[model samples]
Target chain A: MNAFRAVAVAMLLLGMQGGGVPAVAAPANAVDKPVRIDIRNFAFAPATLTVPAGTRVVWTNRDDEPHLITSAGKQFDASRALDTGDTYAVTFAKPGTYAYYCSIHPMMVGTIIVQ
Target chain B: MRDANDSTNERRRHFLGCMAWAGAGTLWLMKGGVLQAQPLGGADAASAADASFSFVQISDSHIGFHKEPNPDVAATLRASLNMINAQSTRPDFLLHTGDLTHLSRPEEFDTLGQLMSEARSGKVFYVPGEHDVIGDNGAEFFRRFGERQQAGGWYSFDHRGVHLVGLINVLNLQAGGLGSLGAEQLAWLKNDLAGRSADTPLVVFAHMPLWPLYPPWGWGTDDSAEAMSYLRRFGSVSVLNGHIHQIQQKVEGNITFYTARSTAYPQPAPGQAPAPGPLKEVPPGSLHRYLGIRDVRHVQGRQALAVTEEVLS
Candidate 1:
């Protein structure tokens, strides 16, 4: 999951400043590091999140049961059933409010807002 | 050597402890539901091996799934087919309750198709579980296996005086993720059963439990009571389902409701764990004990249906 966040941040940095790998943190701190979403008790912790554009979020399954991270819209592929200890990462590139649920257990729902 | 065996025994004890905590009185329901004054389980009646016709029932294949508990679902499914093939009298057909694929991926369907092709049964019938319809209202699944069902992916067929109906209750999941068979399916079921003789033997198959096995985990269907109401008049009724991934049986009146174990993996018994997914970290070689197939034999003259299970291992 951290590697995915690093790659996502790397892409954002490459797009911001051409021809350079900047070691120093700047505006990247907020958008680069991921926000954690823990899936436990058949729900997404902090069922909602508001992060800046280019921000990446990582959902880790902490429950004994399997869960999924699926966007309600066609924004992303519904995640495969995630066994305990499995992690799924999704990055919000554009600015918009996206809603999602565990397709397996439709009762579960969460939201992500990017600005 | 004694030390290793001792640790294994401890682990089994721990697992059984967790199971008992999850299921208290309900554990007895596994076999005792037949005595609940609804249907005659007829469990006491000796199940006759000889039958004029028979069919095999399997559920929750969950192909394309790669996770703990059972990573090689295809292989387990093959194991099931091997059992089917080895049956001395080849079953006239096979009934797949639902959840054919995990994420409903094309490759999963491809794999399920290939493994099923190896079955010695005459034909395989399917009813969609919620997982099978995950992405696009089951268009992909229907496109591949939906031709025979007249409409709504639910159909009824007849074999040797037995009327079999396959219903779809997972199309629209209800509260608590309970399976639902919309009005259309219920009306069709009502009309479908019309005019049939009361003595005609009946077998109904669906993806979710038609009777509310456990509501908290969506183990039961919402409006199946109405659907089941249509069949009370029949002399014999057997409702088969999957999705719980464990065997639980109930007999209410002439209606017998049974849920099959999954070939993929076992889930915590209903309401056992926080929520139902897969039960993992089982003792070695114990997984097969939780997986198996149900074979139904229909003899021309018999008070009790020969409904029996054979474990995958």
Candidate 2:
């Protein structure tokens, strides 16, 4: 839990700097795209993720059921029912901790830390 | 938690009525004090045709849902249409309780419309489910089906001397579970039924169950009791709902409450699973057993509507 708080703090600091350090020192051959979060078996593959600001996270519903990505504070971000093979992408322009869940199934929660 | 819920739902399923899964179906006809399971095609066919009018009910078609126990939901919906088309005496119209589409996508609605175009019934009535209004405040759903209705998208009509009300209870979800029909709709409902005679049979359809079928799973509507208060005087009343993705019926006083099965996929019986979502792990070929629609037949002189559960056999 403390580690999560530390990450949240770091992301907060980075967000203040405006689009924190590049998510990764991209290799010249790497393609620039959003990080993928797969919704399968009613849960996000990586329950929690840390990425740099200006990084886009694309959530793909690979399960047969529909899953949504809604931030804790609905005003932050929310997606349509992400049906099978449907994808929702949002760029984390501001650094902070965004806790989201599939509003349909509140148990399926995930966290994304923007650094 | 799941195990505990499974046991509770198991007991509740037995206590309420026989468990009618997707396959081992049971359609109980209640008369007086006798509750008996009758075949889908029983001797009541002729009687059902003589004095009664029938309307096919298909709910939670969930048109864009492609996953597990049943991946191709369109096939099940097509099967429902086929059943409706093949009805011995054609039903008057179709009533889609709610959850027409999984994600409320335009293409999803397009697919639903494309499939519905082939249905035998020309008229299909719909109310928005939480899934249908996941993101927008039912703007898209209202754009498609909420026509000439009040601002909140609720209206009532009459068919065969029975007053049928389509109520919207999914607009404002409270605390993440259970639907709420604001006071405005309830007032409209009360006013709508004010002038009607007490003998008028009332049928109310919504996406969420009006009665508190199960609060833990968000299966019931919060302010539906107010809506029910208006219809309490009616001699015969039936409430049709979807979203639980299974059929659970209750007969109280003069009213009968029924939740419909989904044409897309089945959810765990109330509290059977950790939460109410699609049920996976069921064998593929047998999915049709759990996915089907309800057929309601109202004999003109009778006080009850003979409800039947016909699966995709």
Candidate 3:
């Protein structure tokens, strides 16, 4: 009985330790970072991008006219007009492919792939 | 006695001819209100038909733009409407070939809507420019004007023996600043034009140049060849686009392509400047002079349409 109890205790401890490892490891995968984007003259500077989940993407309008970062069929929208030198940023929390454009200039488009 | 009467009659006939020529010139100048050069070769041949239906093309209104080049877009748009209203024959409707608002704001759309209401011609047809659909794939524009179209804001209507197609190329833009017609829209376009007879006059309106205008600034459409292929069967194909913000014309096969000037501001000609942006301050009052509207007339049995671009001075 004594040996069995010791074995059971060891098993429980191993299970607990195994469960804690992923709990601690999960956050390492969720490293949140910020990204920068520039909007200018009818095009997005970095036309394509890949970032981790919880990344923040900032877009600066370097053109003389106003611009917006809006996505199709998604809630992501920086609809506020970004004038010359104006800046707008959004932190993407979910992991998926995101395509966005300057609501003002549909031709001005960019994509963000969150993994 | 007979010689005197004959000379008098001859002088009277000559005077009448002179008066008729002056009257025709005056009417032409009035119709060609802005500084746009006269229609290019074959433009008159296209206008030989007396189809009598007229439509207005208003491009690059660049609202919310406040700068030296064109500080007052609203005023220029107003002037464009005034000119449209003043036409000897009012247009059946207005087709705004992209760039309806500079900022794509709710308020900007509202301002544009309000200003456009003053237009004597009712029923405005709109498509997204790269600027107009930047933020939300044109959520605000779609919310307000999308219903006018059927397929993601591209639709077709027939009026007075003419088929008008409003297309969406600004949605998926290419790297060269070329507009795109995506596979879906391309299929739809093929189906749309499939049944129409070759004699049908087809007027295709979009934001970017269907024919190569200037690729460096992203002024042209990358998939325009596919679009043009679908249109090739038609005897009279008129492609009206507006991203260049200047008046330019090109003829390919049976298609006549034209680019309209911006009602708000003027960008430097392709490759003329270091990069494309609202041109730095022009001489005061010169900006509005560049803004104008295009008047297209389709005459029956003619292979071309009379396209006249008049700018606001």
Number of the top lDDT candidate: 2
Task: Give the candidate order by descending DockQ.
Answer: 1, 2, 3
How well does each candidate reproduce the native contacts, as fnat?
Answer: 0.31, 0.24, 0.29
Candidate 3: regions farther than 4 A off = A1-59, A67-81, A89-115, B1-51, B147-149, B174-177, B288-313
lDDT of 3 by residue, B1-313 (tens): 4485674465445433322110000011112111122221112423422425556667888777777656777887787777666665555787788888876778888999898898777588888787777547777888887745564778998876778898998885532246788888888899999998887878888988887787766667778998999988777677888877665677676777777767766666676554566655455655443333223332222334444333222
Of the two candidates 2 and 3, the one with more favorable TM-score, higher being better, is 2
Number of clashing pairs, model 3? 21
Error of 1 at A32 (Å): 8.0
State the TM-score for model 3.
Answer: 0.67
Accuracy of chain B in candidate 1 (TM-score): 0.79
- Per-residue CA lDDT of model 1 for A1-115, tens digit only, reads 3445566776787878785665544443556778889988777898989887887899998975556777877687677767679998888899998888776666677989888
lDDT of 2 at A18: 88
For every model in order, what is the number of clashing pairs? 5, 3, 21
**RMSD in angstroms, candidate 2?**
8.3
Residue-by-residue lDDT tens digits, candidate 1, B191-273: 98998998787888888889889876667777888988899887677788888877677767677777776777777666655
What order do candidates take by lDDT, descending? 2, 1, 3
Candidate 3 second chain TM: 0.77
Instruction: Give the range where candidate 1 chain A is weakest over 10 consecutive residues by summed lDDT.
Output: A21-30
